[model samples]
Target: MRCVVLPGVYPPQEDTLLLAAALRRERLPPAARVLDVGTGSGALAVAAARHGAAEVTAVDVCGRAVLTARLNGLLAGCRIRTVRGDLLCPVAGERFDLVVANPPYVPTPPAPRPSRGIARTSDGGEDGRTVLDRLCAEVPAALRPSGVLLLVHSALCGVRPTLALLAAAGLRAEVADRALVPLGPETRSRAGWLLRRGLLAPGQEKEELVVIRAERV
Candidate 1:
């Protein structure tokens, strides 16, 4: 069986694992220079390398996640450069032909599992716009002209609002792909948590997983 990524230092979540599976089923164009932001388990990064991306840089905010990405790269026999810093922080002055982010878009508090690395922002923080705001701003600088940016995140994390933010950041955005999947345990629990805080609908967890595609203008 072909795996999207060989096992990494940190176990991959179901969505990311599924994302890799989906990517493997597609054929990217030639000489793609790829960057995988928030690269927790290095699944997408390794996928780019294994499938022949000319350049691959995998970065994450968590120090441990970097180690995991490195280990995963090694185990998979793919030479991916792993860095530690907050979204695009380590790669300042660098650019890529394709940028991928599975950010902490989960609109949850800081109580999420430290090791899951889902990229949760502050307290689901007022319409869940925290991390997406930063990412929308940061992505354009890193994207090469004609480069594509792919962001995988949730509907409840405010995809519409995020699209607006991306436009304000001077990037053209579209929903290139979408999926409906089981919310992770923490995201599933967001209903009660948000309700206690006087937010959320009864069935908000049945949310869309959007793949926001972007390009530098």
Candidate 2:
């Protein structure tokens, strides 16, 4: 699908593609309600809409991302509701048949989150679970009975913790797909820090990105 990604907005990458593939495997009824949290460029939202989802709501905290997503949706010929808010805030009190997210999961040094620039798109705090943890914790509240969430993050963030968190949140969660890709520039620059944090082994250059499927049971 064609998408217009502004400079500050994250462009679709491998993780996005993986999530889209996983989304295709799900059975989205024609009237299914879908939500794409952190919908960078609205790729997943449009994909969900194209896959027969009747309604798609996309949320992002970045103003540029919100506009970019809206434009991308128009370009893709899908009607997507784009909202600007952190994580699930914009969709409060709403339940969705399907939820998708590709939140920041990179293990970065402890520091105040940047107000503008690429850090906001990739930094996920020390353990790389800052954003992911919140997503796992709050998703249960937004998911209808039997609704599914498709989330993607790197294994460096600890996949088991994510699973345990979702399980504790009353959702049945498991890794549905995985891809071993070379570390990107950001990760490569933090190689030493990741090594010190025991997240990356010595000489380890590849990271496994996992697509997790969690269902409200």
C-alpha root-mean-square deviation, each candidate: 3.9, 0.9
Cα deviation in Å at residue 154, candidate 1?
Answer: 0.7
Candidate 2 structure quality by residue, lDDT tens digits, 1-217: 7678899888999999999999999997658999999998899999999899999999999999999999989998889999999999888999999999999999999888888767789999888999999998899999988999999999998999999999999999999999999898789988998899888999997999999999999
TM-score for each model = 0.81, 0.97
Task: Give RMSD (Å) of candidate 1 vs. truth.
Answer: 3.9
Give the residue spans of candidate 2 off by over 4 A.
none
Off by over 4 Å in 1: 1-10, 21-30, 109-126, 196-200, 203-205
- Candidate 1: clashing pairs of residues: 104-119, 107-124
Whole-model alpha-carbon lDDT for candidate 2: 0.92
Candidate 1 on 29-107: residue-level lDDT in tens? 6777889887877888988888789889998766767887887788888999988877888889997888877766666
